[model samples]
Target chain A: MSESLQVNTMADLMAQGKKPEVLFWVGCAGSFDDRAKKITRAFVKILNNVGVNFAILGTEESCTGDPAKRAGNEFLFQMQAMSNIQVLNGYEVKKIVTTCPHCFNTLKNEYPGLGGNYEVMHHSQFLQKLMEEGKLKIEGGEFKGKKISFHDPCYLGRANGEYEAPRNLLQELDAELVELKRCKTQGLCCGAGGAQMFKEAEPGKKEINIERMEDVEEAKPDIVAVGCPFCMTMMTDGVKTKEKEDSIKVYDLAELIAESNKL
Target chain B: MGISNIFFIIALAAAGFWFAKNLNKIIRNINLGKDIDRGDSKAERWKKMFMVAIGQSKMVKKPISGALHIAVYVGFVIINIEMLEIVIDGIFGTHRVLAEPLGSFYNILIGSFEILAFLVLISCLIFLIRRNVLKVKRFGFREMLGWPKTDANIILIVEIMLMSAFLKMNAADYVLQQRGVEHYIQAGAFPISGSLIVPLYESFSTGFLIFVERVSWWFHIIGVLLFLNYLPYSKHFHIILAFPNVFFSKLDPKGKFTNMEAVTKEVKLMFDPEADPYAAPAEPEGPVERFGAKDVQDLTWKQLMDAYSCTECGRCTEQCPAAQTGKLLSPRKIMMDTRDRLEEVGKNIAKHGADHSDGKSLLGDYILEEELWACTTCNACTEACPVMIDPLSIIMDMRRSLIMEDSKAPAEITNMLNNIENNGAPWQFSQTDRANWVNEG
Candidate 1:
């Protein structure tokens, strides 16, 4: 599925004096986590099908230092951020799109303070923009009339004030988009933000993701769509914990859209 | 001037002096925190202050509570305008001084105040029931025990008494005026008091009605003065600080954790090739700067003000994922603890000198490491705060102190931080393998 993919490195594109319209920042999770990597491929497939000009930083990209920053290690966060800024500025990158909300948040909001300014968008926003521009066409396909629920990523929804793009994209897929009880500004966390993804949750009556899954069960959607890799991991685990993985599915927004487009 | 007039002056003077002294101490306690400039945006701040504080905009997010609260809040503020007349009447030994000059306008003002006071009384009764009988989930959290619970009830009870006294005073005055008694002018309208309450006083003697009017008037004024003095000690302090707290709210995106400039300088120095490695430091080293907050004194002044401004409404804790799912980290508790610790520190300083130590700090003594680690940093608490308090920032600051200063973090967090430093990502994968997903078949 992935071998025939055509991807350009920022270095290669710069060598040819050709700049892509956007830099696809494949974040740490999108690059390394096997499950998130598929979401990355799915988004890339849609991008390729639409023929939107985009390039990846490939090995030149490192962690955006989001986890370290969130975990209260400002020294390490700045070290990573300063290096990334140097590399980004060297490329004269003007725009960025990422599948990860953490990367999108860090690069878009936290980077400018450290002198790495760019127009950054989450892939859902980017895809929604492409649809708005009449460049990308999505048919209902398998998603027609299917009950889908979107788990809002904290960084995307509350953190960045973006609650529309992913939902708009889902609407384009012709899915019966239902909302979880706590959504938008009141959305529950997947228990994976603030570096909690890499650690066990503190002792509690229930895991945060389990609590979120209860909301999902109340909505009773056939599939849970997530815009964040952390949310994806937690929701997938949540579905497993409920022992309903076979009956219910959790898919990233890009993956769902890609399947709908048959990319 | 008469003896009662002098006594009223003495009461007013004493209340004003104590209130001023307490306000000065509060200012000093808040200033003990590190300063940050939230003065960058003046126009935007004023707009927010008017909208959120003056307009009570955000409170309306929860319709029932919001409407009830606005009734009480508006009643309290609007009724206080009557205090001006009360002071003049008490000091000059006059009755309704604005009555003759303002004419029927005074009637409209008093009539509206009477209606508002009735609403306020009703709202306070309902709030008491919500807190005690129905046990609203937010108000019943573990942190709302003891004084916190009693503080809310006391304020409501006090407000109920104050409004009742106001209506009774109007009702008695109306009855005396109807009887054409000496010095009881028919000045202001009393829609609620005159219609509902005056009948109860109608059968009383004119002399007895005069006694009721005088006693009610004195009680109302003294209650208002006592409430004023009580502001600094109670979470009711929010009534005054909410304006400034909302005005200085974080204007940036909620996700943007502040970039530490001190860390940036050090990182820049490390990366600078042209700089001398062995050069003497440019500035003489001052007291070692703590990386993040260990106590209220280490927090920003705005944060300390946030502590003061918290209504202990539990709105933040209600929205917190950890608290909702039974984690020890109640965002409301965080603010309450900060305020409680600040008060302790302020008292210690008052007893001893400015540098006095309480032998306890906000972090270990008040806020537990377990609670600090429980936050997901989702900003729901900040979003849910009607006055825009950022308890998440305080949690993050304390987390920073725990990790960077004390090197005391959950083992998993230490591992995660180490991985990010060593392997670029917050996992053990090599940086060389970052692009391996591209060619995976």
Candidate 2:
């Protein structure tokens, strides 16, 4: 867990030769079952390319337990929290970094209660810092594709107060980006959080994510990269659901970074 | 029923009815929101009740109406206790309890309440005139349609009726005070009614005066109680729920929404080998797969309770842009439907959960496709809710269950979900343009 949060490289894991100083907890969206896995893989590859030497741990990844808590099922959430903590601790892993904002927020915020506490950083913060320190170099590869815009996931933007790191990382990648009328702190939910990502809404008018994705579509951007798995899925689904599948694209910020690298 | 006996029985029936109503309110409010049902301390909950439900803080957009309404609220509560003195006098045959400090000051206290009612009446009239006659502009950021002026009208009628009834009782009291009927207590009201009959009452014979005074006693005490009891069954239930809601308003009002878990991990396996359950956990090997709220009973108990707590003040519908913009959404209807659905579902659940939950996804067309998705998750409903009932969370949860578990979402969301699976974002542009938004040259 600490490895995912980038809190510390614990002593037990230190004896291993060539252990990366920080372990990046690429969440489910960055791993499997998420359409944005390629984008997420790009982020990890960029770090690897930059000599950041980060170890990626998968299968050991647990749901951040945030979904359960938000659904008002505190007990299940606690169980999930403990389950994830035990997995992280078992690895004796310390210092964590993550691509998924929901995972970042939950690890930084919710894990303390279950006693699996560590300093956690979003991949944006980690990657952005790496760039700032000249540790991650960008060679400015030829940029191709439509004008792009970034959708801030509410979990990353609001819940954890992370609006700039992702943007900064994107900036390092040298991509021309457009700002949506609603972004950053005032960013709307992708209709994927608060456990809405899992349940059907009370019937009304429209899917919340679709409503948000429409706003992005109106920006006329060809892509809408987001920081949360739920946002990526919801917005991706929103694009297809709106029949905009051919024109627009969604990517994890990490994947965007990796693509911008000498891939 | 003889003349006096008829009035006496009416008084009895009215008192009984009044009590029955408040009792029902207490029961109804018991179920409105998730937090309230969490057994939070009364001190914590009472704050919300005091500020929102009792205070009607959300209704204050119109200073004119809000202030008058506040006055009426205070007057109704304070004056009712004083009215008890009058009722006791009616039963005891004594015009004044003022043998001591309380009774000594009774007339002065009673007079102020009497006058306050009139002030409330005037303010109420002004409100009515604005909405009905002048058509006072709507409150909030949006305009509401088919807005029932009936809520104001009903409250106005109740207030007017109660005050008129009180005034008639006053008339009887003044008459009796002049006659000095110290022990007139039948409805236990004659002493006060005795005052009503005296002075102005002398115009009539003692027999006629007595009969007329008895009639006023029936209307005054019974009227207030009936209004009290009738509260829960009507929109007026907010009268009670608002008190707790306002006081316990979300500590972080600015926080518009909460985050759900990252994946389905029934265990503490942040490092589990296979920890990716996208939406709903792959249902613990076939537990209940709740795609959405199938019935009102499927809602959190607090949601089921919001029906009774809703004051129907139209604050929610008023603030909702969708409702104003001609979408088929009404925050009011949501509350009512949840209640209706609850009633429908509860009857079945009461029979048996397993029996009732057969072959139906909770998200099945009971709630509309549009209403669920149309909500911006803006917390307008949350902020607008006087009782702190978090309906948005409920709406979102239902959606998540449907989309993630049942894979049943609007065509648009489903399409978007597919895109998310394929791409990391919602747009279909080349993977190359993803970061262009931040580096605009």
Error (Å) of candidate 1 at residue A34 is 1.4
Q: What tens digits encode model 2's per-residue C-alpha lDDT throughout B1-441?
A: 245545555676677776775555345433422333345455766765556667667557446657877777777777677666665555554454543546535556666776676666677777667667786544221222343345547777888777766666666656655566655422222333234424566677666656666666666666666676666445666666555445544443233233332333334454456766465644466445343354454455555555656655565665553554445556766765565454454445547753555444334545565666655444556655546666665666665665555555555454444443344323333333432221221
User: Distance from true position, residue B65, model 2, in Å?
Assistant: 3.8
Q: Over the stretch A132-214, how does candidate 2's per-residue lDDT look in tens digits?
A: 89887665444454467889876666555667887776665555778886676446567766545555564546666766776
Candidate 1 residue-wise lDDT, A79-146, digit = tens? 99999999999999999999999999999999999999999999999999999999988887688868
Candidate 1 wrongly placed segments (more than 4 Å): A1-3, B280-285
Model 2, position A243: C-alpha lDDT score: 90
Pairs that collide, model 1: none
Going through the candidates in order, state the TM-score of chain A alone for each one. 0.98, 0.85
User: Which ten-residue region of model 1 chain A has the weakest summed lDDT?
Assistant: A1-10
Global fold similarity of model 1 (TM-score): 0.98
RMSD of each: 1.3, 10.6
lDDT of the candidates, in the order given: 0.92, 0.59
- How many clashes in candidate 2? 145
Clashes of each: 0, 145
